[model samples]
Target: MTDALERALASLDVRAGSTRRHTLPAGGDIVLPAGSTTLVYLLSGEITGDLALGSGCEVDAPTGDGRPVSGRRTLLAGDAAMSLGCRRLVLSSQSGAEVIVVTAEITPSEIVASLPGTVLVTGFARLEPAAAALAGNLGPRPDGLACERPGDTVVCRSMIRSVLLSAVRAWASTGAWPAPIADPFLARVAAAVEADPGHDWTIDHLASLAAMSRTVFVERFRDAMGRSPAGYVTEVRIREAQRRLDAGASVSEVSRALGYASDEGFRRAFRRHTGIAPSAWRARALTA
Candidate 1:
């Protein structure tokens, strides 16, 4: 995985985007806004951070983990889960630690499911996501690793997503808790959703076409994908939005194409899920 990191990073077009790297002194605190997803990798030294995921929840090292107070280590060397959108976030580092905090300009599920490994560790509030999914964990490259680059710090963010999607697919075949996309009905539904991103679809309608009772369909959908029917639908919408925007659709046009009742609603939802406004993201992600 380490060896692959460099190459993977090189392949990513992040150069078109922007990232911030910091050498945080111990006791440093950084504030992050609501509805943003970040990937913090401990390149060197230990660091502990706090998270506020809204809904009156907080992720702190001292009081949350319920570990032995005396021997508590605030931060260890590792990666943080992809934080889901929430109210705010706080991060602290040891006296002299090096870390790469990649504030992703993408959606939560889009980036999380696209990580390198199926099994990923998250932050305290679970605001972050885990990469370790039960997927192909199958495919052509079980040993594929994150990409690396020519710099002091290595950040193969794009490569990680590719590897994870592959891993998740592999594990699905083995019946990992939530199986991968192996069910034919589910596959058909996926195809249908992708084929008609503008369709005003419903779960009941999908269930009928899939030839299963609504209850059965819901259960199977969750069992196979680890997300509710609506959740998956939202995912499809987000992906479709990306495609349309990349193809040069205005925000309103993209929203209308996705059957969104209002462009404002689409914008809000897009920011909540992707951590950036549609226009800003599109400008950076798909420039000719």
Candidate 2:
């Protein structure tokens, strides 16, 4: 089976949106709200903070050298933090600090959900040298000037994208988070489903692909993936449907491509998963 991380990185898509810089005076505190693609990097000085994560959110920090000691911890220069969902990060600077906050949108949004909701990388420069170099290359663009220049924006976004990828890679290498599908057998099944979501992936077919009996496959798949095989297939299909829809595919076309028996069936499944119909979701995504 292909390495899980490699597969995830391959499917990952990120688009940089807005970038902002903040300078906090000594003894000042700031509340930063985090979204699915938010990243905060400390440029200088130190700050202490606590993360308030919402339901279904998770936090991962270093357990040995850089771990947060309690509910609040301090981050030094070159440190970074990210949250995959809605969160409130309260930061306080003792001797002042400079930070850059960036927002991006990631596709295959499920990848974000699979990752830890909160990631604190203390001493990030040491852990991810190349990413750190990219961050350093940004220097200090006065008053967010980079965002104003189209060419500079492109270069900045590219560097930020690399930083995000490197951060994920560093965290994943630590094995602090669970792989989406840990079992080799189950991973094979998942790879096949993802590679061809339109395939008719019945339990029997999936089991055969995994070289296991249906019963064993079902049990193990649930254990590893936290959902039944059928549910997983539905999830994969819906995610692909979203991607296709975002790419300007019509609802009917998506339904057909994903092997739905009828447009109505696809519509129902899409609404159940996203709480929005395919057409509406496409419109919103396109406009956004």
Candidate 3:
């Protein structure tokens, strides 16, 4: 499920990356001007803060908000509007604290659309024990090691993806994920598509799987997923192709495995979805 969410986000062009670590001294305040969407993960200590997003948006953390912030991890995810509005964002803590901020190069609306009802939109959530440990392990890593070398880029992406996936999964476990996955029919059909993107899927077949007529199924699916069934299937396939290519699979192999009639056919579809040929995308992805 996390993989599906990650792939969907990739197809939607939302790139997540770490920015910098911030430390707030005791009784200190840090004001930030408006900017992109940001995720702040508390690494240590306690803090309380408030934010004003332009005129109508405001986020408030009560005084001594993070007092006794032990064991579990505290996280705040929101756009610059909410975190740093037209005026500015202010952070203060009775005791000092350490936090890592990750900014995604997309607006709050885009993040909401891409992630649906996930925590990324709600702007706040707590990590469970295991998820907290995983996040803590990643908090100290350096940001933006240039991707000039394929190996280094892969490592950087892996780390970034791991943290993002952890965040998504934690929210998912809290039952805050979108309603589609909770629907029995949609869940079953989505599982089928993700499990085997190479499978030849038709509207009729998918409707049958969901025990619905074609007309009804198409309408329901689009309503729930925001895409036609066929379009969703194509997206999953492209994402699968991307994963395989990242793992060093050749174009021919990927094309055949994805059930494309020819390598050229796969190339064209890949370019349509990703804006580049498979070979070109692979080169850039390996070095981007």
lDDT of each: 0.51, 0.73, 0.57
- Tens digits of per-residue lDDT, candidate 2, 25-99, equal 999876666555677788898888765432222223344222223366677898887656566667899999988
Worst 10 residues of 3 by lDDT: 63-72
Give the TM-score (vs. native) of candidate 3: 0.61
Summarize candidate 1's per-residue lDDT along 48-135 as a digit string, tens digits: 5443222221123222321112111244444333333354556666576655444444334433344322122323212212432211
lDDT of 3 at 96: 79
Per-candidate TM-scores read 0.44, 0.65, 0.61
Per lDDT, the best of the predicted structures is 2
lDDT of 3 by residue, 1-288 (tens): 566655544433335555566777888655544655444556666555542222221222221121111122222332111231233445555677766665555323222443421122123323334434444444345463433544753554455555554554444444334444656998899899999999889999999999999999999999888889998888778888987886678899999998889999999998887777999767655664
**Candidate whose TM-score is highest:** 2
